[model samples]
Target chain A: MTPRIAIQEESFDLAAETARLTAGRQDVGGLASFVGLCRADDGLAAMVLEHYPGMTERAIARIAGDATGRWPLLGLTVIHRVGRLEPGAPIVLVLTASAHRAAALESCAFLIDWLKTGAPFWKREEFEGGAERWVEAKAADDAAAARWTPA
Target chain B: MRVLYFAWVRQRVGMAEEEISPPPEVRDVAGLVDWLSGRSDGHAAAFANRKTIRAAVNQDFAGPDHPVAAGDEVAFFPPVTGG
Candidate 1:
């Protein structure tokens, strides 16, 4: 199984990524994907994402590995962009492939939920008029992740 | 040990990375944070609200009581807001 993880400042091509994962693979029957976009808020100019160099990739890979362990996935791809980004820009992408849709869908959700809380990236909102503030963690995200915890 | 800060924690602490050698009694993440807080006003400000801070020892999520030792790459940052 091919599991691709990338962190870069450049934008990613979703089609190319999906093609790379599925190329020459006939066992894949279901593919689930999620793309996270930067939101435009009132007076928001840009959002800057900061991350720890070695830890970010490690954390995401660990989460992806956990997903693979829990589900019968054929392929997994996770890409996260850093640096300054304007509203509506893509910030992250998660794609999961499996022989069945149920496994693909559940693993996709699991990967994203873990990524939200476990990944070590921080977002700083840059607003117009020169004001800036760090984005705070949402309890809702924690709750979302908690639901996946084994009882 | 190498200590790293990220996001607003970096801004508050005023640097990205540094080297420190804590005393032998500084055995865990919380102890390291408390020891680091005394280094300067910037550290104190960065560590002021412990609730907002998170830690990783050797790139793994570590809790307050997580044991740490010399030569570990300890990182401190605010709670993750990534997707």
Candidate 2:
């Protein structure tokens, strides 16, 4: 079992990825997966994603690094796509494995949470009336990441 | 002196990329933004509410004070919306 973290520009095939991770892992009793999909804004027609080439990997590596340190996860995977993407595309994928389901679930959540707040990436939405800008950080996503912060 | 805006910054600034040699003192992201806001009405309007503005140096997440050298690619945008 290994920790795999990827920030890719190309789309990922979930089925193929799942099969490869689960194969020959009889000792693992739990598998956790989180797939993020595009959401429809009130009237936004198109969405584009932008990120830093070198920083994208570094940001993800830091988040994955945190999860590995805090959890007993035997395996983990994180893959996200950049550039223009349509609705229903998988923006990010996280998979975790452990002897118990709790660690798998928690670590998966941790990865996504940290990625949302800690990573540096942004989006633009094109609407018929005009383009809507996203200047402020998402409060909800920031809250989600804060839930795991040390008290 | 290429100033490439990314994501939300590009949309709000109304320019995807530009090139300019900002004055001395305005040598970093923070200084650059201060200088940009005085250039034109559009710039002032775009960066008017800078509370939402965030910047990076050469593709790395950085604070407003991050030093930027000539030929370095500085990107300004909002907090990330990536999944």
Candidate 3:
């Protein structure tokens, strides 16, 4: 089955999204998920996501394509939300279905790793007391992606 | 020249996009920024810090030295904060 790659600004329902990803697939043995939520403690009271119209879609699709090619994955879905969002909301959702748990788990992790480092979307966060700032690239994200490189 | 602003940049500039001709003295990204900063109070405030803004020329990421020509599309926005 073809995978789904979307970058949107709307809020998403997790249960509904899971059902859609596993539809019509009896051969699916394992499903792995990774959800990223906006947090209040992290000073991210609100987030504004900005992305290039064409480049955002192409970059996300390429990552999903690469994930599918690297594993024996039968189905996958990627959902990323843009625009303004409140705290504790899901920012991204990645699902993978495969013949075994290891592949599904690995692909799920890989998807997030690649997304953090490769995707072209940018975020501006609002903090308490009316402060705001653009987030810088984290060194941790780079280190996570580096582990997946072939020796 | 068409100057496009996105996201917070749009909010600060109080404009989505606009078409204009660069001043004779405005030659590159940096010079164009200086010119835009003089447009209005909001423009000045948005361009105030200077360090927070970034520019893209013709959909490609560009630096301050990037050249600007007549009829070129220039986009300005804040530094990328995505993941």
Which candidate achieves the best TM-score against the true structure?
Answer: 1
User: Which residue segments of model 3 deviate by more than 4 Å?
Assistant: B1-80
Regions of candidate 1 where Cα sits further than 4 Å from its true position: none
Across A21-133, the per-residue lDDT of candidate 1 in tens digits comes to 78997999999999999989988999999898888888998898899899999999999999999999999999999999999999999999999999999999999999999
Winner on TM-score (1 vs 2): 1
**Best candidate, lDDT:** 1
Model 1 is docked with a DockQ of 0.92
Evaluated on chain B only, what is the TM-score of candidate 3? 0.93
Q: Tell me the lDDT of candidate 2.
A: 0.78
In angstroms, give how far residue A143 of model 2 lies from its true place: 1.1
User: How do all models score by TM-score?
Assistant: 0.97, 0.80, 0.71
Candidate 2 all-Cα RMSD: 3.1
Better of 1 and 3 by DockQ: 1
Candidate 3, residues A1-151, lDDT tens digits: the string is 6888888888777788778867777888899999998877666679877787765676678778888889999878888889888897888888888989999999999998888866667777898779997767677888888888888
Best by DockQ: 1
Over A47-82, each residue of candidate 2 has an lDDT whose tens digit, in order, gives 667776677787788788889899887788888877
Candidate 2 backbone collisions, by pair: none
